[model samples]
Target: MSSAFLPGFFLGFSLILAIGAQNAFVLRQGLRRQHVFWTCLTCALSDAVLIAVGVAGFGHLAMLAPWLDLAMRLGGAAFLICYGGLALRNAWRGGAALHAGGGDGSTLLATLLSVLTFTWLNPHVYLDTVVLIGSISAQYSDRLAFGLGAVCASFTFFFGLGYGARLLAPFFGRPRAWQVLDGLIGLTMWAIAAKLLVM
Candidate 1:
């Protein structure tokens, strides 16, 4: 990629690097050893879609529709709150993977739900990774360069997220670690929701 595109690539990287609902979910699934490969694939693929949409200049569709923005923000906030609440509940209960016994069937379906949880349900994912990144890329007007940067950024994020979480799994084996994770996730989600309400 050209040097001019580096800034946008980093822009995408910085926006996604922060701990958020999607990251948390990714971490949890990684810990559970549940649909690990496909989970990463879906995350990257979803990012690819969003990045393509932005670099292609179709993100204007999102900006033009007030209802779209509101619906996404509202839905995102609600999903965060509910998921966070679940995390908090799990935290209180303590210990490794919840409902492990139920992990018997349909790994593909479970993975798909996890993908949706990270992609569609998380409001911050769209605003930061999709809208913000797209808008920034649009400023350059060199669609080719902007797109290259966006795709690079997406690959970096999903790779780090999907595999990076695995790095943390060894640590989660200790007692109460899962609880701490859940508590942190709950807080992260609620904080994101609060930020959304103001926007």
Candidate 2:
């Protein structure tokens, strides 16, 4: 269980560490010092809910159809590989950078709505939190521990990103920073995919 927890934590962190609209919004809010806590909490909780659904649903489904476990593993690995390739390609192209300025000055409610939209409406979130994470959790003997680890990672990352945005703003402004981040993300994704394949 303890072993599973650490893997879950690392995997969860790696998956969320990728750059996306949701993360960009959180970073912007953090930099602006606007509804930071609520924004982070909303994103974390949304991930928690989805993670729970995925872990539980997939576990049961795998139980009913034993072959599904292998199928999902293969599918998740394929997805991760494709995603990693894209990240690597982005890294090679090396021109992406965060633009933290020019916020719309939206109200708290509006901001919350926008973040929610970014979270719930994104298909990638479903793929990452639900299908991918869920499928991976099924491989662990202690699925609950794995799920908890993932949940904790989500909370830690969102709060950190939301509160640390100001600190990260300068660092993220450079295209080289984005390239390095993308490179690391690509490597991490491929590593996880390799592990899944070996399992």
Candidate 3:
């Protein structure tokens, strides 16, 4: 069980550490101190649910439907490209700032919706959390332990990212920092979109 748990933990952490739209959104919300807890909880819980589904053999079901995968890929690419464009525009206008105010004018409901959309709508999430992790878990005799380990990884990462963002608050205090961050985010979004389309 320990062996399975360790491998699962590392696999999960490595995948989640990759910079992507989901991480970008979480970081931004964390920096803004707006709904950070809810955002993190949503992300972690969502990952856990997906991982469980995957481990339960949903990956096989997904493989049985090529059309569904294609549709998800196309939709995900479109969303990413649009989001990237918005981020680029924000960077250009110098409007991407970490406001010290209570909220960024985004209501709690809106924030949660955005967070959920970012999580569920991305095809990469399915590929990573469902297909990849699920396939990998089959190698371990104690698959349940492995799945639990992966779930723990999600909880650890999201909460850490959400709460730990404050440590960088001073650096992000500068307007230029926001500009650079948004610029990178825009590029990341575009890159991932291109990957999805090409793949």
Q: Against the true structure, whose lDDT is highest? A: 3
lDDT sort, best first: 3, 2, 1
> What's the CA error at residue 118 for candidate 1, in Å?
2.9
**Per-model lDDT:** 0.72, 0.77, 0.86
lDDT of 3 by residue, 62-96 (tens): 86887988888788889889889987876777743
Position 33, candidate 2: lDDT = 69
> RMSD for each model, in Å, please?
2.9, 8.3, 1.7
Off by over 4 Å in 1: 96-106
- Backbone N/Cα/C clashes per model: 0, 0, 0
> Each candidate's TM vs. the true structure?
0.84, 0.63, 0.93
TM-score of 3: 0.93
- The best-first sequence of candidates by TM-score reads 3, 1, 2
Best by TM-score: 3
Looking at model 2, residue 137 earns an lDDT score of: 92
Write candidate 2's Cα lDDT for 135-162 as tens digits: 8998998888898899999999999999
Model 2, stretches more than 4 Å misplaced?
A: 58-104, 168-199
lDDT, residue 105, model 3: 78
